[model samples]
Target: SLVPLLKGLKPKWRDSLYYHYFEFPSYHMVAKHFGIRTSRYKLIRFYQFDEWEFYDLEQDPDELSNRYGDPKHAKTIAGLKRQLDGLRTAYKDNSDVRAMPIEWRKKYRPGRE
Candidate 1:
């Protein structure tokens, strides 16, 4: 089941610690969800709800509040979104991602498509 890695290919192994998923079954539901995490942040997007939730580990260590849509975190949020897009592209996890591209996801609102 391991591609690019055979019985003795242990040394070339790489870590998939940065990977994230569409939360299968949950992704097909009325409210689709996709999440991504890096060392300093965690971002979750609720597709049907057009909501985004993100936390900054450096500032809010307790995660008591989400900084998403907060003006202070705009740049950070954009950067994270780009990373998430790259991950999804590399993994080819979903076929319809282009319909809801990362750029559109960033601009989406509850009232808008």
Candidate 2:
């Protein structure tokens, strides 16, 4: 299923791909990891450990360094976070819904962005 779809995907037709997976039967902490990727950058967020990572794909294709929490990328991190949040919201993601203040979400929930 995935192979056929992915092989036929046009390079310009998409902006990013986000992936999430959870382990069952053998592990409980696996739910904490997920990744987001764009042509230019990739970021992985690990919730349980509060660990987040960033990579400038163009500059470091091999992914030898971890740029998370780096001051130079704070703006990038903020921007990507907004995008990730938007994607989650669109899919009716409610994992973090309770963590948001009702009034705050109402102010910027939709077209406001």
Candidate 3:
């Protein structure tokens, strides 16, 4: 946790962070996605849409361009994908939609008809 760092304990710095967002195209029309952020790169995966995005923070801080399948960043993307999987396993996030509350499914899920 950041508590140690916040308390001035000089904890080892973290090189990356993991995030998962499960909000469908509900209120803001933002799709559900997950990502990992490092100091130099950010990778996002929109699972339901089968889409992926990667960005070089130094070059594209605004995240306008996607480098997910770029040949130049192939190795980097592979490494990030590995790290993403590790993070998911560590956090025990199986990405199971059944874990969401029924009401939440009815309200936030994109299609319910």
Using lDDT as the measure, the top candidate is 3
Model 1: weakest 10-residue lDDT segment is 12-21
Local accuracy by lDDT, each model = 0.66, 0.67, 0.83
Residue 67, candidate 2: Cα error in Å is 0.6
RMSD to native for every prediction? 7.1, 10.5, 6.3
Q: lDDT per residue, candidate 1, 45-101, as tens digits?
A: 775445678999778878779899799989978988887787777778664432355
Candidate 2 lDDT, 35-84, residue by residue in tens: 77899988876543345779999999998898976899899878888878
Could you tell me the lDDT of residue 84 within candidate 1?
76
| Comparing 1 and 3 on lDDT, the stronger one | 3
Which pairs of residues clash in candidate 1, taking residues 3 or more apart in a chain or in different chains? none
Q: Give the TM-score of each candidate.
A: 0.57, 0.61, 0.77
Candidate 1: lDDT of 23?
50
- Segments of candidate 2 deviating more than 4 angstroms: 1-12, 24-31, 95-113
lDDT of 3 at 40: 97
Worst ten in a row by lDDT for model 2:
96-105
Ranked candidates (TM-score, high to low): 3, 2, 1
